[model samples]
Target: MPSVTIHTTQNVSIDCETARIGTRIGAWLIDAVVLLVAYLVVLYTAEQFGSGFNREVALRLGPIFWAVLYFFVSEWLGSGRTVGKRLLHLRVIRLDGEELTPADHLTRALFLLPDVLFTAGTLALLFITTGGRSQRLGDIVARTVVIQDDPAADLSLADVLTIRNREQHRARYPAVQRLAEADMLTVQECLLRYRRYRNAAHREAVQLAGARLAGLLGIDPEEAAADAEQFLETLLLDYIVLTR
Candidate 1:
């Protein structure tokens, strides 16, 4: 139940569950197995071309070289995913939920030596459990965190306008085409607020939304304000029907 609340640039705070240490270690193990397979293939292919002792050394060193290159390029170009992270539904992202650039990926991958390799991830485990935001040394240095990507629920404009007088509402405000998609979404949220709470804030939101939408569609603001909740519902229905 450990979570980190991230404050985005747009001033929205989102609470996200931190990826558990076990999950992260599992992902790393999966990637390591894949890399091991790839390394064996490379060594077997090279062994066919060289002599005994020299071939033995090439088999040892060549895969390490390829693994380093592979990790760097995959992490960078794959946008902070290796095959394992993708399968585990884990992604590396900035603290603000923004996408990481190649430089950010490179920085984290390069710090793997101290954070993961020499210490068998002892340092990473210490940092993540104690660093407050589930950060490993690489994540701390790169301003990133590994998050489990949970799917969000979807809502449609039509879905928000469900009411008894939907047909009548649609008929009353046929000019809903004047509202853009974003405006329609705002209206949908306002209608939901009005329906759920009917508090001062919710009522005020509906009133404001109804007035603005009425203005956009060339309706009288006085009429819109008088019956703001009904007006907003009608506008939402009109938008849903007209847009479809």
Candidate 2:
């Protein structure tokens, strides 16, 4: 799974994954079309009373109404669907892992004015955001992120199983997590060519791991290093118990 990361003000990376970009953008585009049509209707209504097409009214009301409706109902009822997302399957979530509330809706809606005021000015910033997230002025101010509606978003038994199988030896040892992420060679190479290690560096790693494991287990590190079968037996035992 790809990890989601958000950069802090100081540029520290945080681990998190929001919704998918495809779902969010697809939903937004569908909603934009609907909003545009609705804006024309509102303008047509104003014009029927002899007030003319009311360009100013349409310009102001279009984005405002869409923002308000989307922030409030879409986020609250269906979690940022806005009819389009409900059809296409998407969601908008907060950046801080909180539910979107009424206040969040109103605040983010109000913050959108600067983003849609003109074509090439401040509103142009909507195009430059990273990760395909077009937050606009409001999204930046609200610190909210729109994520996808992935059905399988949690850890499953299979994930745990894979980790267990790949790390059986380390389960009783408590060093699997670190070893899993190491910049070392693959397990295949270590197994097949371990006896032929002529390089000092290769020999060093095997010796160090054995020594470390022995010291941790209160055994003779030299003895563990001398007999590879004992180490393999212990590792296999760990795997068997973990699976059972």
Candidate 3:
């Protein structure tokens, strides 16, 4: 699968796998099935209302409005996931390693008409397959990419065991709560990359992430500089202990 390495301002480089065409197709099909079922339900409910102006509006315009609303609201509230995306563990994220704004979602949603609906997905498929980053028209316009998440890769049995022990442990950094979920995910990715590669770049990623996080958490410079790796690990543990 194609992957992109996003370098954060903190200097942590995280590799994210692009969603495969097959997986994207599956998600689209699932979303289509959901829309079909919803349309059917709407049609059935409309029949109960009998022939009238309201019925005409409901039959003619309701589905269009609902479909638009569904995509917009789902991505916005679900943090870049629709029903299909959530089930498939695919999320839309900015290429710049920043959180996606509402404008980004709106741009993608607007472009979907030409990218998928009007062209019957031909344009999207073409761009995704031919483009280096597997981005469609909407993705290109919005500067976003669809990334696949591997839960097993992110958290191993050992990590889970450690988390279980953290339930009763006091947090070392209460300020870790100031960070968002995305920040913690980046920290986790940096740690994983360093563990797997153990090269200069990956090691720098860990060190940079640790220093950045320590600064963010208001940790003493001497303490954080003493052991960057340990500081990052402790922050991760503190996050789990405080949040979950």
Candidate 4:
């Protein structure tokens, strides 16, 4: 199976599986069921309170309006998680790893009209099955992707380091803030290997990576080689803070 690796603001590289088409359909069904239940309850209430409006019209239109409202509000407030997504351990996030804004959620919900409601989900199905990133039309437009939050294996000791000391890192190596996200991911992987393996090959690889990064940032080679782990950690922290 394919996976999408997201570099978090905390300097953690998480490999989240792209949700498959079948899994996305399952999530949609679960949400549909929830909407059905809500529709029944709301329709019942409206039948009693909506004196001037036609009950049949209310019954027909109320659910659609409520469903749209629910999806929009819930996705935004829940940080791209609906009840179905929460149940299935699925989440929507930006391809660049930033959190979704209210506009992003609204765009996604509004596009559901074309992607799911009108086309019977065929458009969404086609896009997700072929898109490779598990993107629907809305996701593509909103720069978002859905990921399955499955438990990860092969964690390294470097993964244990908390990258919250951004100020300290920036104070030490301000130039590291110029590193790109891809470059930061590379540094992260090397640090993880350095922490996980006690072998000479791993140490040498880390040393080489540290030297190259030091040159890129114009840091003194001797200083970077003296404490490669600390240099890499500080670089990762600077990248995370600046990018975030």
**Best candidate, lDDT:** 3
User: Candidate 3's error at 178, in angstroms?
Assistant: 23
TM-score of 1: 0.58
Count clashing residue pairs per candidate.
Answer: 0, 6, 0, 0
Candidate 2 lDDT, 141-211, residue by residue in tens: 67665544434423211122233243443555333224331212232233223433346675665566556
- Give a tens-digit lDDT track for model 1, residues 49-103: 6455376676657655665666678777766677888778666767865556777
RMSD of each: 11.0, 13.1, 9.2, 7.0
After superposition, the stretches of candidate 2 with alpha carbons farther than 4 Å from their true spots are 1-16, 19-24, 44-71, 116-128, 131-137, 152-244
Model 1, backbone clash pairs (residues 3+ apart or across chains), number = 0
After superposing candidate 3 on the true structure, give the runs of residues whose Cα lies further than 4 Å from its correct spot. 50-64, 153-232, 235-244
- Predictions ranked by lDDT, top down? 3, 4, 1, 2
Candidate 1 local lDDT, residue 190: 68
- Among the numbered candidates, top TM-score falls to 4
Q: What TM-score goes with each of the models?
A: 0.58, 0.43, 0.63, 0.65
Error of 4 at 193 (Å): 11
lDDT of 4 by residue, 75-133 (tens): 88876778888788677877766567888988899888789888989999888888878
Superposed by TM-score, candidate 1 places the C-alpha of residue 101 at a distance from the truth, in angstroms, of: 1.1
lDDT of 1 at 174: 74
lDDT of 3 at 229: 69
Which structure is stronger by lDDT: 1 or 2? 1
lDDT of each: 0.69, 0.50, 0.76, 0.74
Clashes of 4: 0
